[model samples]
Target: MKSPGLTLVSYGGKRYRFDAGALCTELLTTGGPGEFARYESLHEPADLLRWVERSRLPSGLEMPVSEGELAETRALRNALFQVVADRAHGRPLAARELAAVNLAAAGAPLAARIEADGSRGWAPGATVARLLATVAREAVELLTGPYADRFRECGSGNCGLLFVDTSRPGRRRWCAMEHCGNVHKVRAHRARRAEGDD
Candidate 1:
């Protein structure tokens, strides 16, 4: 089950729990440009549906995804990924990437509703485009939001996972303390022991 600000991410056949701080950045886990292309999952309509299922959006969303919509969604995801990476690394954001994201945001976002049981729900007639619009719109908000400067990549040199550091101290350094952070700690301990043997 997807929780707000957290997602179960699968890459290279392993799953890691990630906190992306926003649904928009969570979309980046599906794929990206260059090395990220290897992890691409948005090949067809059903693929996008699965992603929606794992997303932070209130669940029970039944959306129709067209081939055209899938294509647009991938493009938006790649652009969003690049922009966030640039933002996290303190590089200048690219206009082309920003434009791609803005184009996707042109559609109306998914409407939310209250079910008979009082549970939050997505309105009927959901479209992939609309769902992605919600993502893009949030991307715009996050990029310009007060917490925008908190965007970051994992501190581990071998890991490229991205997230927003929402800690009270704003010093979050890895995807999760239980994941990459643990691995980094173990490696540093081994290196220290090796040095002591010299």
Candidate 2:
């Protein structure tokens, strides 16, 4: 069975995981950071297929993706990352970066459909273009929405992942409480104990 919102992969003594809350943010986290080095999950066409299947994209894509399409997806992913990183750092997004995302998003055959529950849903073509479009739409929405103000980079050492802080108090300090938060807590506790002993 597919485990939604809890995909875990290990690197450098740390378990890199996804929260499935946001598609664009999750795309940026396919690689781990620091001494764990860059662990790219989408290294090949098959890898991209796995990611698409695992992510359960809203576009409902099933894959017989080409290597060229995978390359394009990776390029789009990098562009989205740059856009998000710039926005998080309070820097203005470059025109070229925005253009790249917009151009890819335009290629997807997306349409609004009426759902069984009388709600609107997006229906995208069953192609890599559709997947890229879905992800690009997510990035644009995140970067331009009111929630953009809540974007934060992980505060853990060398854990540079970005997340939207949805906490009621808006004081979230880690990407995942069980991951970086616990690490910081344990480190602080050890430091305090050592100081007391000294």
RMSD of each: 1.9, 3.7
How do the predictions measure up, each by TM-score?
0.92, 0.80
Error in Å for residue 21 of model 2: 3.0
User: Clashing residue pairs in candidate 2, if any?
Assistant: none
Considering only N, C-alpha and C atoms within 3 Å, which residue pairs clash in candidate 1? none
lDDT (Cα, tens digit) per residue for candidate 2, span 112-151 = 5777987555554467787788788877777778778767
What value does the lDDT take at residue 123 in candidate 1? 84
Query: What is candidate 1's lDDT per residue for 147-196, written digit by digit as tens?
Result: 88999999988778788777899999998777788888999999999999
| CA lDDT for candidate 1 | 0.85
Cα displacement (Å) at residue 30, model 1: 0.7
What global local distance difference test value does model 2 have? 0.70
User: How high is the CA lDDT of each candidate model?
Assistant: 0.85, 0.70
